[model samples]
Target: MHGHGYGQPVKQPPHTAWLVFLRVLFVALGILTIGFLTWAMMLRLAAVTRRSLDWGLFVAVLAADILSITLVAIEPGDEIHTTGGYVGILLLLCTLVGTIAYYLAADIRHFLLQQQAYEAQRTAPAYGYPAPAAPYGATTVPTIPTVPTAPGAPGMPSASGPHTPPPMPHARVPQPPQPPLTTPPPQRPAPARIDQVRAELDELSDYLRKQDGPEGGR
Candidate 1:
């Protein structure tokens, strides 16, 4: 975000436990200016840099070193050697300046912004109780809470109305079963010709008796 249209820097490194420990170690060792280079090498090995290694801070270091050496050599009666204390002092000073500038770079600022947004989103949890809704005959639309997100990321939009739990199904009130009905047994139907049939049967028996008692039986 430093005015012009420069692309974003390398993505932030993963937040693994070991990486976090190493970051803390390198930060402490940064006092001597070697830690920056070491960390840069690690990032390079991890292929995290998109544009420049060490976030282009090494350029400042190089420019400063050359300028310091040239100024020192130009002085009268000064014989500059690679092993001289002047060279070491100059490199350390340049590295320190480069480190400062690196922290102040546009890419670093953007990264820090992203980090803060991520932290804010994480600290404010997403799984809290749903926003409370107004009861029956409510006057206002209840404020439905939503999760927060970092800039440029997907965001949670509040619901048009408050969230309410679904109504529970009504339990069936089971009734005790009723006893079966009882009735008198039905009567047998009376026969229509029973008395007439009995009279005919008696007349036939009398005819048989008269035939057996004939007086003229030869």
Candidate 2:
């Protein structure tokens, strides 16, 4: 049968030397921000603090780098050298650098805080009293006392017999009465008159004439 134990093979690291080389290649290809980000990530992994500001700064830096790279890649020629393009590229680079710097500063701050906390813990008084030394002697096992039961007398139910619960009363619920069915009375058709039809036609003609007058005026 299969079982779990600490007998499994050693797992490899998530990032290898080849990955590191590729990251270095990316850095050499004018993506210094990415390299800085990689270093920051390593620091975060090593350190205890996981601050939200640090994560936000990393995302901002990555976005700025991606934007700058996209702009440069799309307009490779003299367009990047133009005033507006140059300014945009410069601003993006500045944003990338600024975010990286902010993240590093936060990391430093967290590191200092952690160090200070560690020092405080090391210097703090030991309030825990040493547990009283376990008695150094032979121990006696505890013994439980036996309880004596009284003898059952005359015709009453014996205590040794299993108990049976009484049957519960069943209740009957009343249902609502159904409505009675009935047939509706038949409807009669009204008789048509030529005078009524002539009046309706006259009204429709007047409405049409009024609508046409507004359109004709327009």
Candidate 3:
């Protein structure tokens, strides 16, 4: 049957000057990121930071743009240019995937936090210490009191019904007794090495005096 195929060209979105400007800005950002990454790889710049990550995104987009430009340049005069075109498409697809992944991760984190908040709210006690009781003006529900059983009442178990033995008082764990303090054995005085030094000094002084007297007398 001669019919228009289902694979028809989709209508392109209308492009405004602002949209064009934004595209240019994005391309610029991409270029900047790529430049920074190159600088970092060359050791001309420091390690990555938030700014680096931002720039990397910009670079990725710029790479896509370069690929696109290359494809267009190669496909002059409607001639098929498969290589550059495919490369450009691949770069763009990579960028899109990265962006989507980032957003999905952020959304998942938000969802988890929200779920945690919901769980916290659901589990809060009706009346408790940690959470303050409902405000003064809030409607409060009255609790019913349990009735005490009378002794010897029909069908009522005796007070002696399986007495829960009081939990044995926590035994005072005796810490190991500290070692008894004994007077440290008196240390022997370090041998008098200085005595030999004193004797040598005395001998030298006597020798000096004898030499000085004999020379003076002469």
TM-score of each: 0.27, 0.36, 0.26
Tell me the tens digit of each residue's lDDT in model 3 across 107-135: 34434555565556566632332456588
Arranged by TM-score with the best first, the candidates are 2, 1, 3
Q: For each predicted model, how many residue pairs clash, with residues at least 3 apart or on different chains? A: 0, 0, 4
Off by over 4 Å in 3: 1-74, 97-102, 118-131, 134-218
lDDT of 2: 0.55
Model 2 C-alpha lDDT per residue in residues 1-218, reported as the tens digit of each score:
86453333222333345545643453343345433333344234234345565556556555665666566667757556755566557756576455445544554565456656555545653234333455889686789974444436554554676447789888878889888888888865445676788889999999999999999999
Ranking by lDDT: 2, 1, 3
- Candidate 2, which segments miss by more than 4 Å at Cα? 1-48, 125-218
RMSD of 3: 35.6
> Which candidate number has the best TM-score?
2
Candidate 1 segments exceeding 4 Å error: 1-23, 32-49, 52-55, 59-84, 104-108, 116-218
Give lDDT tens digits, candidate 1, residues 58-92. Answer: 45544555555555555556455545546655665
- What's the lDDT for all of these models? 0.53, 0.55, 0.52
lDDT at residue 159 of model 3 (Cα atoms) = 58
For candidate 3, the TM-score is: 0.26
lDDT of 2 at 136: 81
Error of 1 at 174 (Å): 73
